[model samples]
Target chain A: MIEEVFAVGTSRIHRVDPRHRVVFAAVFSVQTAIGKEPAALILALAAALVLVLAARLDARRVLQRSVPVLAFLMLLWLVLPWTVPGRPWLTTGPLSASMEGVRLSWQISLKSISILLALMALTATMTAATLGHALHHLGVPEKIVSLLMITYRYLFVIEAEFTRLWRAAKVRGFRPRTNLHSYRTYAYLVGMLFVRASDRAERVYAAMRCRGFKGKFYTLAVFPAGRDTVWFSLGMSGLAIAMAAAEWTATV
Target chain B: MDRTDPIIELKGVSFAYPGGPQVIRHLDFALHKRDRIGLVAPNGSGKTTLLHLILGLLKPSEGEVRLFGRSMRGEKDFVLLRTKIGLLFQDADDQLFNPTVIEDVAFGPLNTGKTREEALAISRDTLHRLGLSGFEDRITHKLSGGEKQMVAMATIVALQPEALLLDEPTVGLDEKTHKRLIALLAELALPCVIISHAFDFLSATTDRILTMENGRIVLDEEMRVHIHEHAHKLGSKPHRHV
Candidate 1:
């Protein structure tokens, strides 16, 4: 699911060094999260939208893939207006909605969407391996980087195993229902998956040791920070500075 | 580097898990330069365990493992030896942990202290040799079973090991890829000890076939003899296996 949602393509954003992209995304996300000015938030959203367009990403697909997150944002919109105390804007029977609460919800949703769009435009343009290598070069801990890379590599294998087991159960006439037997079977299924994964882990470790794996994972992927990458990062930084300036002026 | 020196030797090797039955007992095996040996055994017959012992991945309870005239007694010893002897695991997934094919193939050379560019050059050469020149950027998980197996071999072969220890190298491969693998192994001419249940495949690629049963080497003979005599089980009609 993550793989398809973050599908890569050959675009200008894709050509930028993953390390630079990661940094740009991080800085942009931080600014978007803390900026309170509506104009600045809209500018952040516009920047994210520009990135999305420059990358040639499909808007419909991105929005469709982001449904779950959008649903959570919708829930915030539904509850915040009633719970936060402010000037009442609308009322329905015993419940009253507040203008401040609605504005707060709008800020959160827009900021989150902007951050998500920025991530899709930057980090998601590269393969997970590239991103992991970029993170390593950016001073991420070796252990955490390895964990991320290995998890990305094996997630599909685990999913395949799960599908295989699920099929086996289906072949044996198993059906999902709210019963003790169904619950027990599902529990057993999850338990067996972990047991098998652990067993495979031991064998894989032995294989790795046999091949001279000495605690650290070495990578050959190089994300050279070239002219294009520098220019792209500078452009994003300029936009981010403009957003921050707008926020400060609004506060002043 | 004497011609008579064994690439690998295991003397009086015996191993078992804690509180478990001995998986390999008093096993003695040796491979010389240019030796091509095949080990065939049923499940739970210590084939993989013996490979591990030879590589020092699993230390024997009672034995000495020698690699390239050096005794493997500690982690440092094994680390040095592994660069000379590559072991291909039964499952390609187990052996391949990198996100892309090139990285997985380059991992061994990189870990053995090659510079990134050198490792990549070696990996690319190995992949080209394995008929996978354009697969460097392909996601390892998304590869076909046969492609994965070939890539796993490429990983080890990139290290340019003097010897190879393969465990069920052709388990999930199609016939065409399987034949290609047999051809590739034959051409490499490295001293190799292969553990596989595919008797026909072993016959095609190996010089001598050894049968292990109950933790001991029970049969050792030329591949032709092994194939001709035991082509079929009792009460089974004999047919041409073309």
Candidate 2:
């Protein structure tokens, strides 16, 4: 059901609450960056992989999203271990790059992956409205939250208008064949969209005001957070417990 | 009749768009209390524009549009005017913008600074009247057109506006929905002016039928005594006879 809201496939990942995934992602990034340690960093990667499997999300789909960071990580692994100088394990040439930089870049890659994975996992499992309600109850500023809500609400309307304009243009044989012409076409398209949107905004504002819209947007009462709240709390504490266990293991 | 004069009396009113053609030229009409009038005209014959003029949405170019005996001027006039006259647009999609159906109905009262509880109560009361007592949480856009139109009427009635103006309220409704709406309108005793094209529906429902030709009222006659008795025997519909 949550998967339907977020437009994600009905996987185990979608079954977990959105807010829990967010908190878990936050803790994973923070605890993994405690020291320049590869083992802890690999542990973070292993956790992300395990989450992917549990969620039943296709591995290729997940890796496709991580392509850019993965390429960067592979490059850093080659150059950093060869360059950064500390105690020279395999003395290369006279370049004398630091081994600490090598370790640091490795940690950076893992940290980036952990954060990215967590965010994608969370977003794919929640609707923008649920995230907004979460923000609204968590003491976030009203203006920002309402603005984002309105933006999300009206995006479909604006896009529908654009689609109409595009269909009309296509009928008139508008084709891009050169860079300059393409740029000009894009500029014209944006300009027309802005003017149309402004006119629509004026009429919509007038109609709304006539209906007695003061300033603030209001909604019917929200549902109780309930069991989802308990799950989020448990997930955060679970992450903390895992981090403590990692520290104890490292010391031993 | 409570020993009072006509609720809305407009004597020899004339209006035109600024630097444009006359949309309501030399219009003369008087609406007494509980007058259920239907104004019918062909497309581009200034039906909706005339309703706008009556609601004090647009000022007369030359003559008077007195609402309850006071002359309307500007913002204050409009504000006072809106409190008395409510307009239901042809497109209910334009009227209802709130996410939930209940919130959409509550907008009018809340905008007037009613307490949240008061707004909720008014919305509930209006819904109950409209036979939608349990549909408070449905999304506005998801409603069918007939449902949307009924909700729009519900929102206006919540304000308890004395005069209600509905522009083409049943253009595309099914026959069953249309008959049901006519019954609902007949039950509500507010002074209403329904702008529509269905003459038989208008003849069946309205107390008086008014015709507009070239932005002017060409004919006004009582439904039972004048139009059906005399006009039906003499010739044809309002457009043919007038």
Candidate 3:
């Protein structure tokens, strides 16, 4: 559940200031993404997994949430090995699994899981509100921060609206089929959802204006840098640099 | 029945959507200080539109909207005027757009140039007033319908508006929440122009009832408690109830 994903708890990782978490996660994610050597990627993955454990996050839940991403990686693994033309690792009739392609797929899969785990551990422990405040304090534009805030807040609402429309369709004997009528109906439903959402946006703006909103968003929460904040950033940055060193050594 | 100078007034008001039929036609109304006015109208009536016009959210084709003794003509004027009159939307989801409840409630105070601590204090007090203490960090979208409604109201009252313009404030509330809302609203000492379809709620909350039909005020009278007597179809005896 979304609520469960964002539930606040007292853990060391959770106590790490949101600004530090955001910056470290972003920098580490970029490092992991650019990494090519399996040794360094493995180290990165291990570091992320250890963070998850230290955070006391539910590993099973994180895996469950990662199912869709893992599934997409599986698709890449299936297609890449047979499609890329290189020194074949295995051959079956006309299909050849290339060693280079397999290695590339492994790299992508490891990077994705490492970054995903890092994000869940470092960032998802805090509420989105905290993240927005962190982003604002990190010098992100107020407009962008507010946009993110509103989008995060209204996502569930729009999803509920979609579900309501879907249920209404279901009760009216609407059935999905491989037919033009079904496709048209689905298109119309999406169009209607957009229309309703736009109308809601207008009303929301009016509501904001009614409360003296003059094209600016203000949040009361402030994430001031404390001792823990500095220590957390230094620790995370050191780990990131170590990973980068590992990548360079492995390539050399 | 206490009345004073008009807090809200509309003169020769007529409104029409672009390339559409007129929604409001030649409507004139005034809400005085200490007046609790309930506007009851059927769906498709111009009740919400009328409220928007008063707030300067919508412009009437040919009319003047005077709020707190000043004619609202432009964006700058409306911007200043809006701080004095809070408008509660029909859907709480539309109103509570901040990531957290407290931030949403504090948005107005912050925009009005209050310090962060001051805004937080105001938000906490307002939420406490609405019986929502400790909901400061509650995710706005994840709240229950009733909680969202209360939080939305808290957002408005945090600004300390002199008047309220409510559009179906109790639309999707459960009975318990509805009663709580009525209680909270009853405690407010500000003028209000409430648009609602719930006749019973209107009867209980407002001092005057105005019924709108076809873009015009069809009825305006002092609200009085009236008992409805109805018999079950299978029973012969009439049951009296208020």
Candidate 4:
């Protein structure tokens, strides 16, 4: 159920150092989230598109991933213009659509899509294991990094366990319907999953101790920054600076 | 330590979980050098609890665990001893927590203060020994059941431990893979305590068998090959004996 589709690639984005990609993603996301100017937001969106293209990601899959965020933005579009009090752009019956609310909604949608695309192209290009190590190298807390790594490792196992339970229920003629019986069955299934997960957790802890784990996770992975990493860092920095300049000039 | 001294010893070990019934009661056991012991029991018979107590994963309610002829009382004592005694958990998924096979195998050696390169070398050598050389970069969860079990074994073997404690090592294995595992266990020279329900597997891999019932050993005997003819009904034959 938990698959790293973007992590498998041969593009230049994949070859770039995961640490550099992570940093760039963070910087770009923060900048796009706070910036309100149309010019800067559009430029950021364009840059994100370029990143998506450079990463060689499938356009169809990218669009599929964006569907949820787009649906959320559509909800905002439905409510914002009619609710906010400002200069009326359109009027019908008792509702008046405002220009200010439309602009605000437009800015938000752009920012959200831009940030999502940027993250998908950059951070998602590396495996979760690489991301965990990169976060550790970038000074994230050891405990948090270990948590991420371990969670990533076991998500599939837990999902498989859940699947097995669900299958067993299905095989036993347990059908779901809008009734208390189905609800109770679902509740029991979830409860059983928690019980099994906790049991597995205890066994996992004991196994960790058996291997002489001393509360510190030592990684054998080494992320070597190559020429591509240097170039990627410089390019991202230049784009961010240009976006900041655009935002500043537009504000003035 | 003398050569004849028990490598692992339990004296009057008794334990009960908080607000739970006693899992183990006054259990005394010893593992000597060159001892290949199999422990068999029904579920909830304290076989696994016994192994955990010896590893210091659980503190006995009333008794002591000794390893290498030294009494172990605290977590600090088990920290150093764990590196010397490898353990294979009942579930391979619980034992392997790393993304890739090599990382999981190298975890023990890395914890023991081996350098990255040294740990990787040890992991490679261990995997090679277990006939899993090409699985270094493979995602651990993607492997088959038998493969995961072998990789779990490789993780422990990488530690170069003095002894091994295996819990249900043959739980989900097929006949061919089961034979392979038995052969692999035979190749290892270190003493081991294996927990399993399969009498045939135990007989093949262990020198002695200990049966447990209600948190106590009820039968301890030398494992011997016992072959007998069984009847089969086929075709027009009333009863065919082989």
The order by descending lDDT is 4, 1, 3, 2
TM-score (chain B only), all candidates: 0.90, 0.83, 0.90, 0.92
How well does each candidate superpose onto the true structure, as a TM-score?
A: 0.93, 0.67, 0.90, 0.93
How would you encode candidate 2's per-residue C-alpha lDDT over B177-234 as one tens digit per residue? 6777777777777887888777767765777778787667766554332445443453
Per-residue lDDT over A1-252 for candidate 2, one digit per residue giving the tens place of the 0 to 100 score: 112233355665666555555556667667866734566567666666666665666666677778998898888877886666686555556655565766677678878887667666655555555556556655578778777755665565567678888788778898877789768877888899999778566555555655655576654445354564576557557756766676778788
Model 1 is docked with a DockQ of 0.75
List pairs with backbone clashes in candidate 4.
Answer: none
- For candidate 2, give the lDDT of residue B106: 88
- Which candidate comes out best when scored by lDDT? 4
Task: Give candidate 1 regions above 4 Å deviation.
Answer: A225-227, B1-3, B220-242
Candidate 2's clash total is 7
Worst 10 residues of 4 chain B by lDDT: B233-242
Q: Rate the local accuracy (lDDT) of all candidates.
A: 0.86, 0.69, 0.85, 0.89
List ranges where model 2 is wrong by over 4 Å: A1-4, A7-146, A164-196, A223-225, A237-252, B1-22, B25-30, B53-70, B80-84, B128-135, B220-242
Between candidates 1 and 3, the DockQ winner: 3
Candidate 4 lDDT at B84 equals 94
What tens-digit string does per-residue lDDT give for candidate 4 at B1-242? 77778999999889998899999988888999989998877788888888889899989989889999989989999998987998898889999989899999999999999999999999999888788879998988889999999999999999999999999998777677788788888888789999987777877888888877667675655544365556555646542121
By lDDT, is 2 or 4 better?
4
TM-score of candidate 4 on Cα atoms, chains taken together? 0.93
Q: Write out the backbone clash pairs for model 3.
A: none
> What's the distance in Å from true for residue B127, model 1?
1.1
- For model 4 the local lDDT of residue B172 reads 73
